[model samples]
Target chain A: MSDYILHCFAQSGNAYKAALMLELSGADWKPEWVDFFNGATRQEGFREGVNEMGEIPVLVHGDLRLSQSGVILDYLVETLGTFGWETEAERREILRWILFDNHKLTGYTATLRFLRFIAKTGETDVVKWLETRATAAYAILNKHLDGREFVVGNKPTIADLSLCGYLYWPDEIGIDLSPYTNITRWLETLKALPGWQHPYDLMPGHPLPCA
Target chain B: MSDYILHCFAQSGNAYKAALMLELSGADWKPEWVDFFNGATRQEGFREGVNEMGEIPVLVHGDLRLSQSGVILDYLVETLGTFGWETEAERREILRWILFDNHKLTGYTATLRFLRFIAKTGETDVVKWLETRATAAYAILNKHLDGREFVVGNKPTIADLSLCGYLYWPDEIGIDLSPYTNITRWLETLKALPGWQHPYDLMPGHPLPCA
Candidate 1:
C-alpha cells in the first residue's frame, strides 16, 4: 500500500492525465474514484478532505494535498526527475502549449462537446460553434506539428499527454479531422506509448482513433 | 539587468499575476506589452517569440519560456523561496483554491460577465444567468474567506493574488459585493500592500489590484 492516494473520477480526462503521469513515473499510489455524476465532489467532507474547493485529480501524499493536473504533473516530474519531454528551452515551450491546450483548445472544445453530448441540451448553434473552435484549434496544432513528431520537440511529454486527452475526442462530437495530417500522425505516435492504450481502452464509448 | 523578461498585456489581470510574482521575487525584468485587443498577438513573429499560441504573461528567464499563470506562479514560489502564503501542509490547499479560481470562479464569472458587458449579446435571461453564477462564485469565496485574512491561511500567497484578480472586477460588471463582506474585507487588506496600488493606478479601468 503506497502512502500516496489519488482522488478523481475514473473517466475524467483530467483524472486520466494524473493517473497516466503516476504510471509513467512508476510512483506507488492508490487511485480512489470520486463520483462526478453523483455530485460527490460537492460534498462538504470531500471538500475539506482535499481543500476548500472540492475538485478532483487531487493527490494526497500523507498530509499534503496537491490539485490541478498541471501542478500535479509538474510536481511528479520534478520529484521523479523524469524530464524526458524536452531540454531546458523546450520545457518552456511545452508549458506554453500545455497552457494553450487548457486556455484555448480544451477550454472551448471540451465545453462544446460536453454541452452537446453530456448535457444533451443547448442551442443548435453549438455544433457550428464547436466546429469553428475545433477547426481553429486544429489549425494551430497543425502548424506546430508541421515538421515535428511531438508538441514541443522530439519526445512525448506531459504537454502531449495533456493535449492528447482532448484532441482524441473530436470525431465523437462530429468534428472533422481529415485536414490535420501532422496532428493525426502525432496522435498515432503518442498512442504507440505503452500506457497510452489504457486510457483509450478505458474511456467509455471510445471514439475511433484519429485517421 | 536581470535575465528575466515577461511578455504581457499592460492591463490584463492574468498578466499582472505573473508580474506581481516577479516583483515579489525581486528579480530584475522588463515588461514587453503585447497589444491583445488589436490582435498583435496573432503575428507569427510575436507568436514564435514566446508562445506559439500567443498568450501573455509568458515569462522568459534565461532560456526558459513559461506560460500559464498558475504554473508560472508555482515556478516563482519554488525558485524564489518566497513561501509566505501558507504552511507546508497548506501549500497544496492554496494551490487547490488557485485551480478552483481558474476552473470554477473565473470559469463561470467570465462567461457571465462577457455575455453581459463585452458581447452585450446574451440578453435573453442573461441577468439571471449572471446572478446565479456570480452568487455561486461569491458564496465559495465568502466561505473560504469567512474568518481568514488570506484565501488559504493567515498569510497571503500566490493563491490570493490569483483569485483577487477575478473578484476585483465585480464593480465593473455590476456584481453586488455587499453580501460578501469577508471577501470585501480581504480585498481591502490585500489592496493595502506596498506596490499593491501599482496595478490599479497603472491600469485604470482594469479590475484587479495588480491588473
Candidate 2:
C-alpha cells in the first residue's frame, strides 16, 4: 500500500486534479478506483465512509481523509512541498483562482461534458446553456492568462491544476479550444511539466464499459 | 470614510455573502452599488478596474482589493477575527464545504434564481434543467445540515454564510424550500444571529427599477 490512496475514476476530471498533483510531486500514492458510473458515490455506505458530499477524488493519507479537490490539492502542497505558493499574498491569489475555477470553470465545463460526452444528452437547450457559461469562464481565464505563464505567480500552482482539470477534455466537453489562444498556449505550458499525465492515462475507469 | 468598501448590488447573493459577514462582524464597511442590471459588470471598464472575472462583491480595504466571495469571506475572517476556524483541521473542513457551495449549491441555485426570477425566461427546458440540478444540490446540503447547527462546526462560519447567500429568497429562486426541512431550519438558525440581514436589506439596487 502506498502512503496516499486516492479514490478516483478516469472520466472524472475533478479526481484527475489530485492525481496529477500527486504524480507530478512524486508522492507515494495509489489510485483506488471508484465505480462512479454505477452510482457508487451515491450509495449510503460510500457517503458515510468516504465523502459525505457524495463526490469523488477522496484522498486518504494515514489518519487524514480529505475530499474536495481544492482541499486535497492544498494539502498536497503542504505535504509534498511542491507546486505551491511562497508568500501569503501568492497563496490568496492561488486560492482566488481555485475558487473561481470551482465556481465557474470546472463548475460549468464538467456538467457540460457529463451531459454531452458521458450521459449523451445530445444538443439540448441545457447543454447549450452550459456551453455558453463554460465558454464565458474560458474567456475570462484566457484573458487573465494573456501575459502569464501559469494561473498564479511565476510557476505552476494548485490554481492551474484546479482550472485545467476539465479543460483537457475539450473534445468530450464539446467546446472549441482553438479560439482561446491564450488558454491553449497555457495548456501547452502545463502539459510540458515533467510527470504530467492526461486524466485517462493517469486514472482508472476510462472508456466506460457501456461506451 | 468606512474602513472597507464592498462593490455590490441588492440582487446579488454572491455580494450578499460578503455584506452579511461585514455586518455580522461589526466591520466598518460601505456598499458601493454596481448597476449589474444595466451591464455594469460586463463593461470593459468594470472588468478592467473592478474584477477581471466580471463579477460582483469586490471588497476594497486599505491597499488590498479582493474579488470572489470566498476570498473576500476568508479575508474578512482574518481581519475581523470572527466566523473563522480555530484549527487547521477545522479550516480545511470549512473550505471543503465552501468549495461544495461554490461548485454545486450556489453554482446551481444562483443561476436557477437568475433565470426563473430575475431573467423571467419562463418555464423553458433550461429552467427545468436548472431546477433539477439545483434541487439535487439542496438535497445534499439539507442532509448534511441534519443533526448539525451549522455547516462546518457547532458555530456559524463562512461556510454557513456562503451557503446561505442565495437561500433567503425562495420566491426569487422559484424552488420551494419547505421540502428541505433541514435547510430551512438551518437558515432560521443563521437568521437568528445578531446583525443578520436579508440580502435585499443588506445591499443596494434592490427591487429593480423595471420590476
Candidate 3:
C-alpha cells in the first residue's frame, strides 16, 4: 500500500495543492478518485467518513485521515522534510501567504473558474463580482512577487504551492495572465521546479463530459 | 510601550480575531485603529508601510510586522504559549480548521457582512449569492461544532478564535443564529472566556458616524 492516499478529483485546484505536494515530495502516494462532479462529497456517508467540511484533497496515512491542503502540506513538511520553513519566522511568513491564498486568491479565482468554465454559468453579477475580487487579489500577489522568486523565501515553500494552486488554469479562469506580469513570472519559476505537473496531468476526473 | 500593537478597526472581524487573541492571552497589547472606511488600507502609503495585502489586522512586535490573522494567531501561540497543540497531529488539526475558516467560513461571511452592514448594498444578486455561500459555511461550522466545545481540539485554539471571528455579529449579517444551536452555544462558550470582549469593545472604529 502507498504511504499516502489522497481523496481527490482532477479539476479541484485545492486537491491539486495536496496532490502536487505529494508527487513533488517523491512520497509513496496514490490518488483515490472522488466523484466530486457527481456530488459525491455531498453524500452523507462521504461526510461522515471523509472531510466534515465537504471539501476534498484529504490525505490518509495508516490510521490517520487529514483534510485541508494547508494541513496536509504542513504535515508533509515534517514527514518529507521538503518545501518547509527552517524557522518559526519562516513558518509564519509561509503561513501568511498561504492564508492569503486561501482567503483571497483561491477563494475568488476558484469560484470564478467554476462558474465560467466548469458550471458554464455565463456572465452574471456573481461572476463579475468574483472576477473583480480575484483581480484585486492577483494585483496584490503580483506586487508581492515584484522582486521575489517564491512566495515566502528564495526557495520554494508551501506558500508557493498554495498560491500557485489555481493560477495554472489561466485559460479556464478566462483572465489574461499577461496583465499580471510578476505573477506570470513567479508561476513560471514554480513550473520550472522538478516534478511539477499541471492540475490536469496530476489527478483524475479531468475533461468532464459536460464541461 | 505595549509589546504588541494591533492595527485594527472595530468593524473588522478579521482584525477582531487577532485582537481577541491578544486580549485573551493577556498580552501587553494595544489597538492601533485604522480608518478602513476612509480607504486607509487602499492608500499607497499604507500599503507600502503596513500591509501589502491592503488589509487591516497587522500585528507589530518590535521590528517585526505580521499580516493575516492566522499568521498572527500562530505567532501568539509561541509568544503566549496558550491554546497551542502539544503534538504534530494537534498542530495540523488546528491549522486545518484555520484554513477552513479563512477559505470558507470567514471568506464568505465577512464579505456578506461587509455588503449587508457596511456597504449597505441591499438585496442584489451578489448579496444573495454571498448569503447562500455564507449560510452553507455556517451550517458546516454548526455541524462541526456538534458535541464539541471547540474546533480542532476540545480546548479553545486559534481555530475557534478564527471561526468565531465574525459570528458574533449574526444580527448584522442578517443570519438567524438560533437555527445553528451548536454555533450559538460555541459562541457563548467563547464569550465566557476571560478577557473576551466584543469587537466593538476591543477595537476602534465602532459606531461609524453614519451607522
Candidate 4:
C-alpha cells in the first residue's frame, strides 16, 4: 500500500493537480484509477463510500480521506514539505491564485475542453460562451505572469501547480496559445520542473477505452 | 476610516461573501462600491491597479490589498480570530468546503444569476447549459448539508459564507431551491445568526443606476 492513494482518471486535470503534486514531492503515492467516464462518480455507491462531493482526486492518507485538489495540494505542502508558502502573507497570496484558478481558469478552460474534446459537443453556444470566458481568464493570467516566473514568490508553489494543471492540455481545449506569450512562458517554466509529467502519462484511462 | 475597506458592489455575491463575513465577525468595515454594472472591472486600469484578476470584493486593510473571497475570509479568520479552525484537520476541512464552494457552488450559481437576472439573455442555449450545471452543483451541496447546521464544525465558518454567497439569490438564479430541503434549512439557520444581513443590504450599489 502506498502512503497516499489518489482516486483519479487521466482526463481530469483537477485530479492531475493532485497526482502531479504527489509525484513532484516524491511522495509514496499511487493513482487508484477512477472510471469517471463510465459514470462511476455519478453512482450512489461512489458518492456514499468515496467523496460525498461526487468528484475524483480523492487522496487517502491512512484514515484521512480528502477531496478537492486545492486541499490536497495544501496538505501535501505540509506533510511533504515541498512547494509551500513560508509566511502567512505568501500563503494567502498562493491561495488567491488557487481560488482564481479554480473559479476562473480551470473553471472555464476545463469545461470548454470537456465539451469540445471529451463530450464531443462540437461548437455549440455553450462551448463558444465558455471560450470567451476562458480566454479572458487566460488574458488576465498572462498579464499577471509578465515579469514573474511563477504564480507567487520566486519558487514554484502549489499555485503554479494548480494553474498549470489544465494549460498543458491546450490541444484538447482547442485554444490558440500563441497570443498569451507570458502564460506560454510560464507553462514552459513549469514543464521544466523536475519530475513533471503530462497528465496522460501520470494517470490512467487516457485515450479512453473507446478510443 | 473603517478598519477594513471592501471594494464591492451589491449585485456581486462574490463580494457579498466577504461583506457578510466582515459583518458577522463585527469587524469595522465599509464598502467602497465598484461600478461593476458599468464596465468598471473590465477596464484595463482597474484590472492593472486594483486587482489583476479583474474582479471586485477586494479587501484593503492598511498596507494589504487582498482579492478572492476565500483569501479574504481566511485573512479575516486570522485577523478577527472568529469562525476559524483550532486544529489542522479542522482547517483543512474548512478549506475543502470553501474550495468546493468556489469551484462548484458559487461558480455556476453566480454565473447563472448573472446571465438570467442581470444579463437577461432570455433562456438562451448557454443559459440552459449553465442552468443544468448549476443545478447539479446545487444538488451536491444540498446533499452535503444534510443533518448539518453548518458547512464545517457545528458553528459557521468561511465555508458557509462562501457557499451561501449566491444561494440567497435563488429568484435571480431562476432555480426552485425548495426541493433542496437541507440547504433551505441550513440557510434559515445561518439567517438566525447574529449580524446576518442580505448582500443587497450589506453592500452598496444594490439598485443599479440602470435598474
Candidate 5:
C-alpha cells in the first residue's frame, strides 16, 4: 500500500501541484483518480468523505487526510524534508509566492484553460476577462523572475511547484508563453529538475475519453 | 511611531485582512494610505518599491516589508503570538482554510464586488460568471461554518480573519447574506470579539473624493 494516497486526476492542474511534488520528492504515493469532469467532486459522498471543500488533490496519509494543494505541499515539505526553506525569511518568501499563485496565477489560469480548452467556451466575455487577469499575473511573475533562477532562492521550493502547476498547459490555456521570456526560462529551469514530470505524464486520467 | 506600518486603502479587503489582525491583536500598527483608486499601485515606483506583484496591504515592520494578506496574517501569528495554532495539526488546518479563502472565496468575491459595486459594470457576462463562482465559494464556506464558531479550531484564529475579509460588504457585493445563516452567525461571533472594526472604519481612503 502506498503511504500517501493523492486524490487526483491529470486534467486538474491544482491536483498536479501535489502529484508533481510527491513524485519529485520520491514520496511513497499513489494517485486515486477523481472524475472531476463528471461531477465527482460535486457529489455529496465525496464532499463528506473526502473533503468538505469538494476540491481535489486531497492527500490521505494513514489517519491524516489533507486538502488544498498549498497545505499539502507545505505538509510534504515537513514530511519529505525536500524543497523547503531553511530560514524563516526564506520560508515566508516561498509562502508569499505560493499565496500569489493560488489567488492570482492558478486562480485565473485554471479557469481560462477550462474555458478555452476543456469546456470550449470560446472567447466569450468571461474568457476574455480571465485571459486579461491571467496575463496580468503572468506579467508579474515574469518580471519577478527577471534575474532569479528560482522563485525564492537559488534552490527550487514548493513556491515554484505551486506557481508552475497550471503553466504547463500554455497551448491548452490559449496563452502565448513565448513573449514571457523570463517565465519561459524559469519553466525550463524547473523542467530540468531531476525528478520533474509533466502533469499528464505524472498523473492518471489523461487524454480524456473524448480526446 | 507605530511599530507596524500597513500600506492600505479603505476599499481593499485584502488590506483589511492585515489591518483587522493588527487591530484585533492590539498590535502597534498604523495605516499608510495608498491611492489605489487613482492608480497608485500601477505606477512603476509602487510596483518596484512596495510590491513587485503590484498589490496592497504591504506590512512594514522595522526593515521587513511583507505583501499578500495570507503571508501577513501568518507573520502576525508569530510576532503577535495570538490567533495561532498550538499544534502542527492545528496549524495545517488553519492553513487549509486560508488557502481555500485565497483561492476560492476572496479570489471570486473580490472580483465580483469590484465589477458590480466599484466598477459598476452593470451585470455584464463577466460579472455574472464571477457571481456564480463567488456564490459557489460562499455556499462551501457557509456549509463549513455550520457546526463551528470559527474556521479552524474552537477559538477564533487567523483563518477566520482571512475568510471574513470581504464578507462584511454583502450589499456592495450584491450577494444577500440572509440566506447563509451559518456565515451570518459566524460573522456576528467574530464581531463580538474584543476589538473589531469594519474595513471602512479601520483603513484610510474611505469616502472617495467624489463621494
Candidate 6:
C-alpha cells in the first residue's frame, strides 16, 4: 500500500511542490488529483480531506492529514531523506527561499495570473497593481540570481523547486521571462529534471503557457 | 563557545520565535539586539549580516548566515532536536501555521496595528479591509481551537508560538480581543509559559507586564 496520498489539482504550483518532493524522495505515494477549476477543493468531501481551512496540496498519510506545500516538502524531506538539501545549513536557505516565494512572489504573480488569464480582467487598477508587484518581485529574483545558478548556494534544493513551480506560470500569462535570464536558465535546468511537468499539463485544455 | 548568534530587535515576534527555540534547546547562543526604531535593520552592517536580503531574525553560526524567521525556526528544530514540535507530523503542522500567519494574519494585524497606533493614518479603506481579514483569520483560529488548547494538537507547538506571537499584538493596536474568547484564553495560557516576554518590554518606555 502506498504510504501517502497527495490530494491536489494536478497543475497547481503548490501541488507540484508536493509532487516534486515525492519524486525526489522516491516515496511510495499516489496522487489523488482534485479538479480545482471545477471547485473540487470547495467540496465538502474534499474539505473533510483537509483541515477546516480549505487549501490545496493536502497530504493524507494514514490518519494524519498535512496541509501547506512548504510543510509537506519539509515533512517528505525529513521522513524520506532521499535528497541532499536535507542538511542543516542548506535546509535553512531552502526554507528562506520557500518563505520568500510565498511572501513576496506568490502574492503578486498569482494575482496577475488570475486576473490576466482566469479572471479575464484586463488592465484594471488591481491588475496593474498586481503587475507592479510582479515586476518588483521579478527584479528582486533577477538581482538575487546575478552570479548564482540556483537560488541558495550551489546545489539544487527545495528553494529552486518552489520557485520553479511558481515561475512556470509566467509564460502562460504573457509575462516576458527574457529579462530574467538567470531565472530563464534556471527554469530550463529544472525542466530537464525527471518527472518535471508544465503547470498547464495537469489541467486539460487550459492553453499551455497560459497566453 | 556558542554555536550561533541571533540578531533581532528585542521584542519582535519574529525574533522571539527564534530565541524561544534556542532557549528551549539549551543551545549556546548570544543575542545581538537591533534597534528597529533607529533604523538599525536598514544599515549596511545589518544588511551584510543577512546576505543581500537584509531581513531578520538573522542567525549566524561559524561561516553560515541565515535569515527569515520560518527558516531560522526550522533550522533550530532540525539541528538542535530540542523541541518536541520538530517531529515529522508536528513539523508539517508547524510550518502550515507559520505560513498561515505570515500570509494571512501578519499582513492584516500588522496593518491594523500600524494604523491604530504607529502610523495613525486613519485610512478607513485600509483599516476596514484589515478588520475584515483579521476577523476571517480569527474565525479560523477560533474554530481550530474549539476544544484543543494549542494550535496544532494538545501540546504547545511552534504553530502556537507563531500564531500567539502575532495575535498578542492585536491588543496593542486596540483590537478588541473580547470577541475571540478562545483566542484570548489560549493567549493567556501561552503568556504564562517560561521565557515568555511581552513585546513592550523590549521597548524603551513602555510599562512591562507584571509577571
Winner by DockQ between candidate 5 and candidate 2: 5
TM-score of each: 0.80, 0.99, 0.98, 0.98, 0.99, 0.81
Worst 10 residues of 4 chain A by lDDT: A202-211
Number of the candidate with higher DockQ, 2 or 6 = 2
lDDT of each candidate versus the true structure: 0.68, 0.93, 0.91, 0.91, 0.93, 0.70
Tell me, by DockQ, which candidate is best. 5
Per-residue alpha-carbon lDDT of candidate 5 for residues B95-145, written as tens digits (9 for 90 to 100): 998989998999999989998888888999999898899999999999988
Candidate 4 clashing pairs, residues 3+ apart or interchain: none
Q: What is the TM-score of chain A, computed separately for every candidate?
A: 0.84, 0.99, 0.98, 0.98, 0.98, 0.86
Q: In candidate 1, what are the lDDT values of residues B1-211, reduced to their tens digit?
A: 6667777754566777777767755767677766666677788887787666566677877767777787778777777766345454476566666666665566556656655665566554545654675577778788878878888677778888877765666754568888889988998987777656445443334443332
Pull out the clashing pairs in model 3: none
Q: What lDDT score is found at residue A195 in candidate 4?
A: 97
What digit string (tens of lDDT, one per residue) describes model 1 on residues A27-113? 787777666666787888877766555566778776666877766766777666663454655665666566666655665676667
- Compared with the true structure, what per-residue lDDT tens digits does model 4 show for residues B15-88? 99999999998999999989888889889899878998888889999999999999999999999998898789
What TM-score does structure 6 among the candidates reach?
A: 0.81
lDDT of 4 at B56: 82
Chain B TM-score of model 1, please? Answer: 0.82
Q: Any residue pairs clashing in model 5, and if so which?
A: none
Better of 3 and 5 by DockQ: 5
Q: Is the docking of candidate 5 incorrect, acceptable, medium or high quality?
A: high
Query: Scoring model 1 with DockQ, what do you get?
Result: 0.31
Q: Write the per-residue lDDT of candidate 2 for residues B1-211, one digit (tens) a residue.
A: 9999999999999999999999999999999999999999999999999899999889999999999999999989899999999999999999999999999889889988998888899999998988898898898899898999998878999999999999999998889999999999999999999999998899988789887
Q: Model 4, stretches more than 4 Å misplaced? A: none
The i-RMS of every model, in angstroms, reads 3.7, 0.8, 0.7, 0.7, 0.6, 2.2
Error of 3 at A62 (Å): 1.5
Cα RMSD to the true fold for all candidates: 4.9, 0.9, 1.1, 1.0, 0.9, 4.5
